[model samples]
Target: GIKISDSHDEPELEFFDRVPTVWDDTKVIHGEVGKYITVARRTGSAWFIGTITNDEERKLNIPLDFLTEGQSYLAHIYYDDPNVPTRTKVGIKNIPVTNKSTLEAVLPASGGQAVWLEAQKKFVHPGILHTQADIKRTHKLIDNKTEPAYGSFLLLKEHKCSQPDYRMEGPFRIISRDGEYRHTKSKMEADFSAVYQNALMWTLTGNKAHARKSLEILTAYADSLTMIPETNDAPLLVGLEGLKIIYALEILKYTYPGIKDEDLVPVNRMFTEIFMPVMENFYAARPYTNGNWGSIVTKTYMAAGIYFNNRAMYNKGMDFYLHGHDNGSILHYISGETGQIQESGRDQSHCMLGIGAMATLCEIAWKQGDDLYSALSNRLMKGYEYVAQYNLGYDVLFSVWEDVTGKYCDWKTISDKARGNYMPVFEIAYNHYVRRQGLQMPYTLQVLEKIRPEGFDRDQPAFGSLLFND
Candidate 1:
C-alpha cells in the first residue's frame, strides 16, 4: 500500500504536512467491528478524524460535540467519491462548525472518509464564566417570561440594590489576628458580592443603577484599600475578596463605556499590587490548606487572569488547579471514583463549598477551551453526586481520610451535620454534566429540582437559575 507512483498520490499527502503526529486528546466517537468505525483525535486545538466501513456501504452522523463550546472551527472533509476527476476518486469540501454541529458521514462500500477541524477565533473575552451568547439566551428567556429563568429573575428582583457608601473614610486595612475584623471582612464580601450581583442584573435587565453601583464599589476599592488583607484565619477568610466583581467587570468593561480602561488602572493595581502579593503568600505558604481554600484562591486567579488578559496568570492558576499536590486540585479533592471529598467526615456544609468552587472553576475553564470539569474521569461530577446523594438523605460510600492541614483526622464516618440542606450549587453542575453532556445524575437532578432557580449561596456567583439553566 506504500506504492505511490508519480502523479498518483492524493492531496492527503500534502495535508499530512500540517498534521501533528502526537495528540493531546482522543475520542472513539463511533465504531463497530466488521461494520464501521470512526475515531477523532485532537492535537492541540486542531482535531482530525478518520472513518472506514466494511464491504457494505453505510451512513453515520458524527457529532462535533468534542469541540469546545461557543468556539468556531473550519472543517476540511475528504471522502471517497464515484465522480471525481482524480485517480483517487476523492472529494474535498470546507465548512465552518462549532460544538453544536454534526456532519453527514457517508461511506462507500469498502471506502472511507477523513476530516480535519481547525480552530478559529474565540469569543470577545476568554476565561469568562458566561459569554454574550449565554446572556443573550437568558435575555430571550426572561423576555418571554419563561418558567425557570423568569421566575428566578422575579425572585432576584425582589431584593433592593446595594447603595455602597464607598466614599466613607475608607474600606481601610482588613485585619484579623484571631477574630478581629471578621465582621468587617463579612461586610466587605457582601458589598462586593452585591456589586457583582448588581452588574449581573444590569446585564440581564439593562439597569443603569446596577451598573453604576458595581463601578462605584470598584472605584472605591481602587482608591481606598490601604493595605492588603492580613489575618491569622486569613487564608480561609480574605484575599482581596471580590470573585463576583471580577465577572461583573468582565461584562461591563467591553460592552459599557461607563467604565474606561484608564479608570481600570487603579482597579488593576488594586488586584496586582494590593491583592496579588497577599494571595501569592497564602497559597505558597499554606499549600496544606483545605480544598475549599484552594478552590477560592484558584478562582481569584481565574478572575484576575480574564480581567487583565494575562494568560500567564490564567495558566498559573490552571497549573495549581490541575497538578497541585494540595487538597484543592480536582485529583485530590474528590477521592477515587466514589466522589467522596476530604471534608466529608468533617462537615457537610464545608463540602458544599469545595463543590461550588469547582463548579465555577470548571465553568470558567470550560469557556477557555479547557475541560477541567471532565477532569479525572468526571471526578468533579462524582464529587457533586457524592455530596448531593448524601444531602438528599441517602447513604454514600465514605472512608477514613485525612485533610492537608492534618487538623481533622481518624474520622471513620461521613458527618451527618447539615445533611438535608441542599445548597445553591447543583444547578450549574446538573445543567453541564446532565443536560449538556447527557449524563445521568439522579441525585444531582433531584437536588436541583428541589431548589430550582437556585439563588445566592455565598461569596460566589449563585444565580445559576437565571444565568445557567436553559
Candidate 2:
C-alpha cells in the first residue's frame, strides 16, 4: 500500500498555490470510500476542487454542475506529470468551464490533482475609509428634517458662520508653565478644535471655502510644526490635542478632493514621528493611574492608527484600553460592582473628561468593527449613569476609595464642582444608546435634552452634538 505522505514531490501543492482556500466554505463533496477523497471550497467568487486517491491509480469524471448556471469560468488544472523532469512534476492547463462542463481527472498511485475556477470580471481596489459607514449614515441623517439631526446641522452651520478669514502661522511649540502646561495646553486645544469645526462645516455644507480654509490650517501646521515639547501636561497635550487634530484631518480628507498629496505627506509624518511616539512613550512609562490619562492616551493612539491605516498601532490602542496600567484600565476605572467611575472621588470635572474620552474611543472602535462599547458587558453605560445621576441633582448611594484607608470605604458624595460646568460629551453616548440602539438612559437622556445642538467646547474630543447628536 502506498502512503499519501510518502510522495516526496506532490503536485497537489500547485493547487493550493493557484487557488486560495477558504476554510470556512470547505466541504467534502465525495469521500464514501477511504481509497479516494474529493473536496470543494469557495473563496470570494472563485471555487477550488481537489481530489486524491490512495495506492490505486484511477480515472474519474468530475461534473461542474456546482458552479452558478449561465456564468462562465476559467479553470486552471494542476495534474501530476511523471514525464516532467522536475521532482515536483506538475502539468498545468487553462480551460474554459461552465455549469454544464465536465472533465476527466487521471491520477497516479497516491497522487492528487487541484483545480481552480475563477470568474472573469474587472478588479477593483477595496480602499479603507477613514471613518465607519455608520458615520456616513449619520452624515446623511444630518440633512433630514428631524429634531436632533436638523438642530445639529444648524449648530454646525452657525459655527461656520462664526469663523474668521483663515490664517496660517506655526512651527508652534510651548513648554510647561511653572511646572504646569494648562495655559499652553488650552491654546493648542483651541487651535485644533477650530480645525475640526472647519472640517465638519465643509462636510455638512459642501462649501468649498470651508474645505479650503481647513486645508490651509492643516497644511500650515503639518509643514511648519516639528515637535511638541514634553511638558507636565504632555500626556494630555499629545493625546487630547492629537485626537482632535486627527478628527479634523479625517473630516477634511473625506470631504475635500483637492487636498494635495504633498500637504498630507508631511502631516502623516508628523503623526507617526512626533505625536505617536509621544503618546506611546507616555503610556509605557506611566500605565494605569485609575483616572482619565489611560483613556486619553489610548484615544490618541487609536486615532493615529486609523489615520495611518496601521493595524499594529490600532491593536496597541485596544490593548491599552482593555488592560491599562494599575488602577487605570478602563475596566477597573469603572467599578463592576457599583457602576461608578474611579475618578468620581477626585471630582466631577475629571470624571466627565475620562468618560467623554472613553465614549469617543468606543465610537471610533465601533466604526472599525470592534464592539468596545459592550466590551465590559456595558460597564461604560454604568459609568455614565453613575455620573449623570449626580449631575442631574439626584442622590444615589455608592462606595468610593478613601485615601486614608487605601480602600473603597467611604460613601459616595457629589463634589462642589459636580454638574457645575457641563461638558459637551453627552451627545455621542446619547446617540448611540438612546437614539441608535434604543436602550433607555433616562438621566443621560435628560442631560442630552438640556444640551441639544451640542457645540464644540474646550477639552471635548468629538464635536459632540454637532457631529453625533443625530
Candidate 3:
C-alpha cells in the first residue's frame, strides 16, 4: 500500500480492492536535477512521491487516498526534519484513510517531503505490524560492495582532476584549444561528464565530504558553460562530449541514493534547457559528416534520450545506429575532407570508444524496453570477441590491423605514440575484463590503480608475465 500527498494534487490512480503486491522494497530519496523524489516500491507496486523546488521554501500537502481506502493505512513519513540525527529518519503513524483523505506535509526551505505507506489487511490492521523487511531488502540491493564501488568509480573517481601532462598533448586537447572554438570554450567543458560520474560514485560511497566536493566541481563547470559559440569547426565533437557531461548528471542521481537536491539543480538546468536544444540542432543538421559518424552521434543522442526520458529521441538514436545510418554499427569517424566514412581502425582509443558506445547503447536499450537493442549490444560484444579469440597474440595484442592501404598491419607499428602505448593489451584484456568471463588485466583500470603497490599482480600469468614487467 502506498499513499503520498501534496497540495493541489489529485490522485491519478483510484484506490480499490487492489493491493500493491509488487513493492520495490527499496526506498531512495534524493534530488533529481532540481527536484526531490522519494520513492518506495513494494514487490511490483511503486509509490513515487516527488517535489520540485528552486532556491526558495514552499509548502506541500500530500494526499493519502492513493492507497486502498477500505483497509487500515499506516504511513511511514520521512521528511527533511531540522532536528534529527539522520535528517530523513522516518516516523510511523496510524490513520484511517478514505478516497478523499489528505495529509499535510511541510517542506524545507529548498526541500520537500516523501512518505511510504503500508496497508494492512482489513481484518488485521497493517498499521500495527512493524517489520525490518523493507530496510533489510534495501540494504541488500544497495549495500553490495561492487554496486557502490562501481557507482563511485563511474561517477567520481574516474574523473580525478589530476590533469596529467600526457593528456594535454592528445587530439582532444587539440580540438579544445586550436579548433577555432569560441573564447568561452574551456577544457572544463570537456571534463564535465567525468566530473559528475565521479560525483555519483562519491554519493554512493557515503563519503559525504567528497560527494559534496564533487558536486561543487560539477556545478561550477556546468555554470561556466552558460556561454558558448553557436558555430565552430569541431562543433560535432565538442557538442557531443559536452552533452555527455550533461547527461551524466542525470544518470548519477539514479545511480546513488543520497544525492542532495542542491547538488542536482544546476546540472538539471543545463541538461533540460540548454543541452537539449543544442543536441536537437546537431541531429537536425546532421552535423557530423553526413551522419556517417553515427557511432559518436548515436551514443551522444542515446545518452541525451535516456537522461531526459525522451523515448522518441532514444528510439531515433537507436534507429540511427541500427538501420538509419549507412554503416551497420553506430560508430565511424568524420574525415576533414569530403565527409567520407573513416576510421582510426582497431587502434586503442578507437576500439575502446567503439566498445564503450555499444555498452552505453545496450544500457539505453534495456531501459527503453527493447530486447533487440540488447541483442545488438551482444553482437557488438561478439565483434570485440572476434578480435580476442582468433586475432590476438601475446600481451592481448591484436592479431591483425585493417590499414587504409588495404594491407594487414601490426599493433606495434601504429604511428601515433600515445595510442600505441596501450594498443597491445587493450584489444585483448579490456574486452575480457568488461565481460568478466576471462582472465586479463584492463589497461585503463591498471593505469588508474598504478600508484598502489598491488597495481601489478605478479601471480597472474596474463597480467604479470605477458603484460607488466616486474
Evaluate all candidate structures by whole-model CA lDDT and list the values in order. 0.74, 0.67, 0.40
Task: Give RMSD (Å) of candidate 3 vs. truth.
Answer: 19.7
TM-score of each: 0.72, 0.67, 0.44
Highest lDDT model number: 1
lDDT tens digits, residue span 93-195, model 2:
5677798999778989999888888774321111112344435655677756566666766665665322535443332544232244345544455556667
Specify the highest-TM-score model's number. Answer: 1
- Model 3: CA > 4 A from native: 1-159, 162-186, 189-194, 230-248, 255-265, 286-293, 326-328, 331-348, 367-369, 372-378, 386-470
Give per-residue CA lDDT, model 1, range 226-260, as digits (tens). Answer: 66446655655442354765777787786566777
lDDT of 2 at 283: 62
Question: Residue 208 lDDT in model 1?
Answer: 77
Question: How do the residues 1-470 of candidate 3 rate in per-residue lDDT, one tens digit apiece?
Answer: 43444211111111221235544554443445655444434544334344546666766555554554464444434455444322233232223344466766666666655454544322211100101232233234345533322232332233444222112211122223233544323554335433533443343344555444445555665565453345543434434454446444553454445577777777677655655665566556633342223455566676665565554565566545543423324322222121112233334444434443444444435334443322322344444443232222323322233332243234443223234233222322343335334433333344324321111111111111111210
What's the lDDT of the predicted structure labeled candidate 2?
0.67
| Weakest 10 consecutive residues of candidate 3 by summed lDDT | 122-131
